[model samples]
Target: MAIYSSTSPKFFLSSASTSTTSTTAMSTTKKLKRYLELDSSLEDEIPSKKKQQLPRRTCLVCDVEKGTNQFPNHKKVSSHEHDHNVCDPCYRSHLENEIDSKGWNEVACPECSITLTYKEVKNMTTAENFAKYEQACIRATLAADPDFRYCLSTTCKSGQLHPGGTDEPIFRCEHCGHKHCIVCEANWHQDQTCEEFQAVRRRLHAENERSQQEVKKLSKPCPGCRVPIQKNRGCDHMRCSRCRHEFCWVCSADHGLIFREGNHRHEKNCIHYRANPRAQEPELPRHRIERMLEPDTRLRAYNRGDLDDSDFDGSDSDDSDLDDTEPWDDEADLPLVYEPDLILSEVRRRAPGQTLSRVYVG
Candidate 1:
């Protein structure tokens, strides 16, 4: 019997593989031989390496090695320490996204704070995107100019530089067709000069200040709810709005128990306890303080027939007599009421309407 060791199977397998390869080896060998011979036939085939393609660079953005042909058309993004480049695809996407969100301001590198100028970015992006960027640049440039102004109307979004500026205050917005004052920056004040309008505004502002002071002086805060309550035409006894808690208007002491128990007992220190609040203090409308703050205007109001006897005390309408509430004598109270009819009648009754001339008050 033949010796059958473990190595006998391996020997048989190797011999079978060698026989199979020998048949195919000649065809592969002949092709290689012809290639070498044809290339070297005319001159010695240069001992050379494979043709080198474009140098690959690692992209700063995607961190992928890409050929130089796949870079953006612009120069390197950063000049300083951050000297790296982004791939073409990543660079385009970043530029478009920035233009959409932040506009063409400081478009920095993808991986660093090295910002590029707007012009540099413009050269790298598509034509459509460049148009939008150019538009934004134009808007920014126009906005920086001081002469160019936007229409103040909320409904209109148009503006132009006025040829005569504040020298011609009345500016009619062409878009909205509403006239406004460029100097005052307000709606056109018809039939009044700008100075007159400004004087009226100042007078109104003073009146408002006086009115606020009068309200603060007259109105008292509810102790229970802490809400300001004005007893314009009510008794000293008051009630809160939402809480409905009865309290004293003058002293703000709780009066819930008195109302509930039917006994109107008040704190002895309160003004209501001593005397009737209505009788102690005169019932004057709080706005009279605002109307009378301009003491000079009081005499003018009386002379203009705007002040009525019932509206104020019968005292002389003079700055010196503001504190004097004493009633005037009968003759003084009836002193020539300045009526327009009386003014015309006095002029005519001078000689009983012989002839009349139109008199205008400027």
Candidate 2:
């Protein structure tokens, strides 16, 4: 392209350069006219100093009217809609409260029951807090596995799932080189059976009356897992350190979220619980309701003894009334304690090329 230039490169100015010089001259003329106040045409073109700011919303949290930007993540996202009700400060304070309570695992919006997604949680929290949440999640996931166990050593805080839990009782902690008896989930028993260890423990317990009295005075058994928990100094809302079971220290009742008048988090027997006559189930979206009927979810519920024949009656469900007596084409409705289908599914997962029907969730 450069071989066909008729004029020498230095002698000829580019068309772009000529256009730029003319544009600069015109801009200078406009500025001079503006300064002289000779032209009123540009007066309307100049933007006004005061902007007509609107779309301000009242924060449901503080009842203070603030700008749209004050709301945290106030946009139509996959997890939630544009929430203009809660301000950024209030929303962040809510997150901090949840984090401090050690309930950052399943933090829901203050406005709704919709759980915060992983990315949302990360964005709202500090890196340290986010890492803690990640560790909590890992612990919870491991806790779901029957073979998982924490190391017995006092100094070591590591835990992992030991394969063949029922078959092999010896669980050696790879983190601290500590050995533990899987059957009893206690310190390693050297040259002794579990029964023998229990007998010895019983005898030792009988001899130590002072320790037992002190324990009885300070600690109480968690209704969920029967693990003994001590309350040093805090509110009646006690959460078991071992099982993570929330319960009232006074009544030793399960600390489930109660939607009653006084906003109770304990059983009716407990003083903290206050019943509301008009209280009913909090309404969720139809999609969320339908998602509960997924195969794997239903199966897990069945395994945990949370489902019954009545739960399968989708026809009676409010808003949905779905005719899904058989919710999924899987063994979700099966009531067997030990399922062979799980083993078969594991086999299929290991060997992907196999043509056999695998037990999969919807």
Candidate 3:
């Protein structure tokens, strides 16, 4: 009645198109539901099947084809329009070998031979090895520098040196808290010039040699104790103060020789018995005795404004007017507290060009 024809071409075409569209929509909804269910249960199941399908990577060092998991600690190098990768173990081995053989300056990549940056090398090395590398670098730098000096204090032998070209002769060792002369390389000789100090040092050395020779000539060993003794003015019969064993000074024999008779006589085997009776020499003059006993007084006089330019040339006419007192000995009473901040500030004030970038305290 309403022109409904079963064989109509328009109606057949519209029905076919609608059926195709509905079927496709239903297929898409079912596929979406399946995907949601799979995703929801993914945590409970082993995902190795999916991971196995992932792309495999080739290690540049070992030339082995491995999954991404094997290169967990890989290092990347990008330079000169090229990219490179090294596995962790291989990178560490290469860095360590380079450091042991050629130091940090020659640390390089095994494949490309290009020098590795500090950050790349540091990441591969251990903490201890990194510290050693830093120290080696510093030592190399110091070795190259001619003006560098080491602190002479035995306790704290720091490698810090004061900047040169300053008028100040005295420089305090920041590590040991000891003051030293930069020119003479000794304890600070504040009062005397470097030349005067050197002259005094030479004279002292000569006097020491002469005194040793005099001791060898004048002194003999005790027979009982082996302690050296010089007979000033007494009989040849000697008693050792250390061992209290009496013996002859000339022949170094037992005291029985003198005990046999009240008179002092040398034994027959004594070296000086026949020609000389081995009597002790006369006592030294009072002035000579004083000079030998108190050599420190004359030695200290140079620092006390007592010794003048004339005394340096063997003229000892003027006596020291200053009292015999050692100022440096009082340093022993001072407290030894290490204040790093104070030392750093003081060093900065004294040497503006020097910079203390790193400090290690144990």
Candidate 4:
């Protein structure tokens, strides 16, 4: 048996494998170098082909290289370092968005933050957008102007371009044929000056306020027509002239409770009737009260033969002259005299069985 050392065989095998790997690597490297040298020689032998170039541009917005024609009439921003170009569509869109969001006053380029001139913006945007920008500018200018006035016509709200320091009170609308006073903001008053018109307006306002206060104080809506009824001085047995609906003034019910019949007889369940039983008593006939209070009126009624103590029913009297819907305004002309004792004595004397409990004089 030949005793061969294990270490020697292993070392020899390792050396052989290393040599093979080195040879393969050297061959691959040489082939690569030769290919490169061949490519360089070919380049040197043949004239370099002219490279074809296409007209191109870079869009600042999208950051894409597009054909130069794609940016026709495009916006450009020139700085010290470089010039920035934006495509037509992108530039128009940016202008429209800026005009819409920031309005005409603050419209600016999104890229360069440069404020665009009105002419530049108008040329870039659409017709509709340009019109909107123009209108916005007009509105802003008018708002800042102290002399600016809008037409008072509902059909046409066109602005009136009144020059500053013009003392013209009347302005005629060019859009609609309506003339109005600028100071009062009302229809033109040919008879009155601006000061007079304003004074009349103030007086009308005061009268309206006074009327409203009177309505709230002395008026109640009718149950049938819902029209406000003001009782200046009348019987509790109220009749709505508009709807012809009869009701008690004290109870506000459709019950037949004459004011002359006494307040307790009106409606026991009514809040007002229960609250003031004596105060809500039936009123005396207007004619009789007038006769008893005013001797001159009584003599006039007697001369006309319209006054009869026995058959003097208020319903029979001609109330055609008086409007039931309106309160009696002539109360100021009449004397404020309350002779309850005299009225009750007269009532007792006229009708023995018809006893008078209370009398309310307004």
Candidate 5:
């Protein structure tokens, strides 16, 4: 501090300025040289335009070959190495299946935002399983899918896409343990490992297993007919295919009692049996029907035109003005009786009070 006082402030300032200028020049020179070296390195790495473009690997899913530049990276399992030409759909499907079987609900493509199941990932065939990372790069032009545009997130349920990236876009659902992709709103990416997510996946696996068991239980065919069995109610009554004898589906034993009307149970010991009630003979309806005959019913004399207008009206109640027309003589030769029993009768075997009746005219 005392040394600065011995020197003129202007002189010191000038000297310091000169030193600063030199340092700036040196720094600038160094930066320029560094930039030149980087440029040279970059040029060396890239091939000339005249160089032939490498052929793209074929995608395994869609079976389309794409350029190498389109691929993101390749992959390998253990010591074995193989080309991953699989398309995005096939890969996503494979991953998804694997994840699901392990109980993972959602799996995102490591490269793309596509969602997949755990089963899809692990069950990949030997060919798909052995793809090299570079060859399997999902970014490859072959990975494009035009049909699928929606995000794969199970929780999002939002079907549309946004123009801009997500705000607070990259979020992990603490409840579901799913990672949401900003662009697609699809869940699959992971910024960090989550124990909660794994637990959720395991729970899903258990639930799936339970579902499969339930399906198996419901899929049993009827022992009697070899047809699919369905439980109408909790009773064990069942019938046969060709015979349809009332017996328990679990044990082929006769139902204890004869069938009554309106009982739902078909158990072996069930009181509900009637030689295959569905095979019962159809019955006709019953009602008494009688025909009445009037002596002058259709005679033309009954016609109002046969009488004078005064006779037809109340002003002329005299029957003397009426015309006496003879009935057709051919009627004498016609049979006096019409068809008999127009009203059908049906007896009730189940309930005596439930006899059905039908009325008819001929």
Candidate 6:
């Protein structure tokens, strides 16, 4: 026999490790099996039980569908109490006072394929039940009536279950050509999977796309002036000050009144002045007068240094004759008029009618 040491540390350690691993593996396996069983049992039992317990529904006003074990049980009338299964709500609905109101007609429940009169639905035993029955009848009738329905989407046509847990809807508006999901009564487009509320959304989108394409295809010049034509690129409206043109973004045609004409003159003036400073000049002097009548005599009279009173002696007859016969070339054209004295007395003696020429002459 091989020599075996009972107290060897290596053997003891190996044994302990194997035991721990085996225990762990066994526990893990057991936990896994338990989980599998739980999953299978839930799948098999719970859903089936749920389905069995779910309420069976039948239209109260019509003979459409009848589901069992549903809540909101209806009681039969006293006349038909023996028949507990009878839908009393449906029976009482046949005697409404408004049967004649608005030409009440007999409408069939589309869901149950049973004819239900409006008078029957309106005559529910209780007000609350009557309202409920009436609503159900309306839904059924609307679903069956082609006039009230639109077309079904492909998804609905293919019978895809709605996310809402109810029976799928089958009714749609005939005019709009829209279909509502059976479960949620939610409408969806034929091409898309998402639920939509408005039927016009797709149409509106197409119209908008068409409009954008038309706008893009159009090639008109800037309405403000005959420049480049980039429609709706920046602004819709433009104002041209050069030609006073006003127009939409596309057209380059001469559109007047975009800018006012009155200010062009001022603007031109300003520009001209800015470019050529000399364009703006001041006015000429306005006060100079011509001294043409008296010439040298007036000049000599005004010039104090030229002559004195000796030139005009009052009593000198010889000087007087000389003055009258003077050979003055400058005064030759002037009339012969003279005074002997050249002082204030002479001016005082002159008549009021005497002008500057006459006064100086005298």
Would you estimate the TM-scores of all the predictions? 0.35, 0.43, 0.33, 0.32, 0.23, 0.17
Q: Model 5, 137-169: lDDT tens per residue?
A: 332323344322333455543233233444445
Q: Model 1 compared with the native: what TM-score? A: 0.35
lDDT of 5: 0.46
The sequence of per-residue lDDT tens digits that candidate 6 reaches over residues 1-362 is 12457687342346667788899999999999999999999899988998887765655446555545321233312222122232444544433333323222444322232444444344334676456556655555665643343346653322222332333345544445556654344564465444453446668889999987876577554544555444445654555555455654433323243232222223333321122112233221111011123344534543544445655433222223222133333334334333223222333333235444433342
List runs of model 1 lying over 4 Å from the truth: 1-52, 63-65, 73-84, 100-105, 111-115, 174-178, 187-362
Model 1 residue 170 lDDT? 81
* Number of clashes recorded per candidate: 0, 0, 0, 2, 45, 14
C-alpha lDDT (0 to 100) for residue 123 of candidate 5:
39
Angstrom error at residue 202, model 3: 13
Poorest 10 consecutive residues of model 6 by lDDT?
A: 283-292
Q: What lDDT does each candidate get? A: 0.64, 0.66, 0.64, 0.67, 0.46, 0.44
Ranking 2 against 5 by lDDT, winner: 2
> In candidate 2, what residue range of length 10 has the lowest lDDT sum?
316-325
Pairs in clash, predicted candidate 4? 259-282, 260-282
Model 3 agreement with the true structure over 1-362: per-residue lDDT tens digits:
12346676442346667788899999999999999999878854657766878767787888887666554243444342343455566667777778888977888877678787667667667777777778778888886775666776777656664566346667787767787787888988878989999999999999999999999899987777778888999787788889898887777767765455322445667764532222333332333322323436545676567776675454435343546632322333233243444333334444568545443221
Instruction: Write the residue-wise lDDT of candidate 4 on 266-349 in tens digits.
Output: 567765453332363555556655344334443455456665653232223442343222223454335445456446645565
The root-mean-square deviation over C-alpha atoms between each candidate and the true structure, in angstroms, is 28.9, 35.0, 31.7, 26.0, 23.5, 33.4
lDDT (C-alpha) at residue 201 in model 1: 90
Question: Which structure among the candidates has the greatest lDDT?
Answer: 4
* Candidate 5 segments whose C-alpha is farther than 4 A from its true place: 1-55, 67-75, 78-84, 98-303, 307-362
How accurate locally is residue 188 in candidate 2, as Cα lDDT from 0 to 100?
80
lDDT of 2 by residue, 130-201 (tens): 787777777888888887889989899998879997589898888989988888878888999999999999
Name the better of 3 and 6 by TM-score: 3
The CA root-mean-square deviation of candidate 6, after full C-alpha superposition on the true structure, stands at: 33.4
